[model samples]
Target: METKARLVAAAREPLWERGYAATSPRAVLDATGAGQGSMYHHFRGKEDLARAAVDLNTDEMRAQVDTDLGGPGPALDRLHRYLRRERDVLRGCRFGGLAQDPEAMASPVLAPRVEEMFRWPVGRLAPVVREAQAACELRPGLDADRLAVAIAAGVQGGYVLARATRDPTVFDSAVDGIVALLDTARTEP
Candidate 1:
């Protein structure tokens, strides 16, 4: 890839894995095998490069969510697809992991992106939930927005649980719990 693309790509893993506080610009440069001059030529500094990397990660994640939730199926099934979608459970979420990093959350550049990362998924999921409710697949009394937030939270929390326990099954169990809850919420046919 091009130098700028390479830098952003290389920065993403460290930023996700190490957080903004620990991921030095030099580490990114070393990973990309690019000189300091190339980094300077492409980005204003570490925060700027981090912003680009975060933006890329956000875009990729949003696209995947859109695909998973927008696919042809019942809204409930789509939601299940989203929850059970393949993920690197042990590695945790890129944006959710960054939110735990104080420096990342405090950065002007990173903060808004992180906030959007959380908000956007909820926004995307809410309508699908509402649709399920409309079709009588879910309880009519259910709060779509809150359920959407819970779904998003379950995935993020699952990642944390999995990472904390060093067991990917923890993540699966969390998802299964959410699935069971959803099934319980379904209207009796």
Candidate 2:
């Protein structure tokens, strides 16, 4: 990997583990084995490095989700595929879990990228919902945009619940419940 990319990748694990407040520039540098001059050469400071890492995570997430969402299947099928896809259930969604940390939400530079990472998936899913409604697979009254938002929230919340309780079953239950709700809602009446 490139030096900058290495820095970002190294930074990602610490940030995910310790979050914004606890993850210091020195920690990231030490983790990456990059000195101050090397880091400064690539990024302005910790915030800049965090933003780059956040963007990298966002892009990776978007690609993974888009692939699932656009896969060969019905919208709900694709949704289920994405929902139940193998994940580091223990670590949780990297970006999603970080957003809940007090420091992450407070950092002006870091917070927006984190928020955008979430908002992108919901935005992309909304269109699939509308298409499902148009095809008469979903109720005409179903609110695609809002439902997308709720589903997105459920996903993040599922990870949070799973991590807090250290139980994968909780995450599975949340996904199953949401999928059931969406399936039922999408069925032809």
Candidate 3:
């Protein structure tokens, strides 16, 4: 059981680094330091094991966002915390990056997992945006749902910009630009 868990954890980094189509089962085995016999014993094959790793990866991503956004604080402050938290910028978002992959996008099996990864955050973010608006931290008449979508876009799009330019600052600048736009929406006393 522990060995299987270890295998999933090992597979996760490679999947995030290289996406589903590129990473090999042998690489996963090497990462976990487990033998082929053990891999087969633990999983049907690479796809089955990759599913486990992807599931774990997506769950972990959700928990982090839930904690940062759901934690008690001023609503906009929570948004700021989420956007400003240090990330492996050049590596990009594990979930968002997967969504862009040709193979992953084409696969019915993989595509929904990627969609859930985006949907969960945007759904969670809506309430936070509503809270910010209620607190007058955001301007009235703005649609919280749209704002939440924008926020998600900013983060995911930041990853795109960073990866394209091979510069982490591109990601940070995207985040900062979104933050500034939100700031402009702040109500004056």
Candidate 4:
């Protein structure tokens, strides 16, 4: 890859795994075998590179979610697929994990992007939930927006739980638990 692309790609893993505070420009340069000059050429600084890396991560995640929720099926099934989709549970969520980083969340550039990472999913899921409610798959009178937020919360919370307990199953249980709660909302037997 080119020097700029290499810097961004290298920055992504460390940013996700180590967060903004821990990931330094030198670390990125070391990872990419690019010189300080090359990095400076491509980015204003660590913050600029971090912004690029975060945006890339967010875009990729959003597309995956859109695919998962947009798949062919009953709306609930689509939601389930998203919840159960393959994830690096032990590594935690790239977007949600950033929320735990004081440095990342404090960044004027990163703060809103991280917030959108959480907010966008809730927005994406709300319509599908409404679709399920309309089709009688989910019980009536439930608030679609709130339910969407809950689902988003469940997934993020699951990551924290699993990380805290040092057990991936804790994550599975959280997600499965959300699915079960949703099932209880089914209009059908």
Q: Highest lDDT: which candidate? A: 1
Reference-based lDDT, residue 66, model 2: 89
Pairs in clash, predicted candidate 4: none
Model 4: which ten-residue window has the lowest total lDDT?
89-98
For each candidate in turn, the TM-score is: 0.98, 0.92, 0.94, 0.97
lDDT of each: 0.94, 0.83, 0.87, 0.91
- Model 4 per-residue lDDT tens digits across residues 68-175: 999899999999999999899888999766788999899999999999888999999999999999999999899999999999999999998988888999999999
Best-matching candidate per TM-score: 1
Per-residue accuracy of model 2 over 78-156 as CA lDDT, tens digit each: 7788888887776888786567787788888888888888888999989888877777777879889999998888888
So what's the TM-score on candidate 4? 0.97
Flag clash pairs in model 3: none
Residue-level lDDT tens digits of model 1 in 1-189: 999999999999988888889999998899889999999999999999999999899889989999999999999999999999999998889987789899989888899999999999999999999999999999999999999999999999999999999999999999999999999999999
Per-residue C-alpha lDDT of model 3 across residues 45-162, encoded as one tens digit per residue? 8777877888888778888998899999999999999999889988989886677778777877778888888898989999999999999889887899989999999999999999
Q: Candidate 3 overall Cα lDDT vs. reference?
A: 0.87
Which of the two candidates, 2 or 3, achieves a greater lDDT against the reference? 3
